[model samples]
Target: MDNPSLFEQLGGERELRTIIDEFVDRVFDDVMIGFFFQRASRERLKAKEYEFAAEHLGGPVTYSGRPIAQAHAAHPIMGGQFMRRLRILEEVLEAHDVSPAVREHWLAHTEGLRAMVTRDSGGRCDPVDAMKRVQERGKE
Candidate 1:
């Protein structure tokens, strides 16, 4: 049999939605990163989260909002906040029992967006620095 697409690996859009919802819920509860999403409407954010996961999982890209960089451009730079959010997101995925391969794939895809999002957010934060911080934290 041919290898399954990432979308299939993730159990399609419904499963992706479940994962996204769980992950975003964790993000919302996080004191360090919750502020970034504080003003966003819950339903709208949930929909966007589903769309983003669908796109990343190799499903249709229905995310019609501004590019991530543009969307985050106005957020303030908070030292290691972005990295902290990523760590939280990873933990959330793990808590949901996402497969290792699927989690790794999603993390790799998200890492590519860091530079664009950070630069767009009007933050001088370096993506490399953020990545380093995450790695350092993982070691502790």
Candidate 2:
């Protein structure tokens, strides 16, 4: 048999959705990254996340969202926030019993996407505080 795609290795669409559901839930509860997701519709977000993951993992789905950088540019996401979210992902994958090789492959792909996801070079500034500072700077 031909080698399985990463999407298949990770259990295809249904299983991936389960993982993303829990992953997004964990993210919503996290203080550092939760600030950025306060208004997210979990249902909608799950679909979009699955599509993005499917496309990246060589699945059959096409990702129809905006470009990654354009999508994240609205947020002042620090490098630290990105790392925190990634750790949450690792935890979720571990909980789901995904294999180590698959997890590492997934992590490497995601880590490579950091530049596109993070607009802030600053590490760990509270996004709300960062925005306030920008407004304060403009007032001066």
How close is every model to the real structure, measured as TM-score?
0.77, 0.82
- Candidate 1 lDDT score relative to the true structure: 0.76
Clashes of each: 2, 0
Report model 1's TM-score to 2 decimal places. Answer: 0.77
How many collisions between residues are there in candidate 1? 2
Query: What are the Cα lDDT values of the candidates?
Result: 0.76, 0.84
User: In candidate 2, residue 73 scores what lDDT?
Assistant: 85
Estimate, for each residue in 14-115, the C-alpha lDDT of model 2 and write its tens digit: 889899999988888897789788887877878888898888888999998888889888888878798888889999999999888779988888888888
TM-score of 2: 0.82
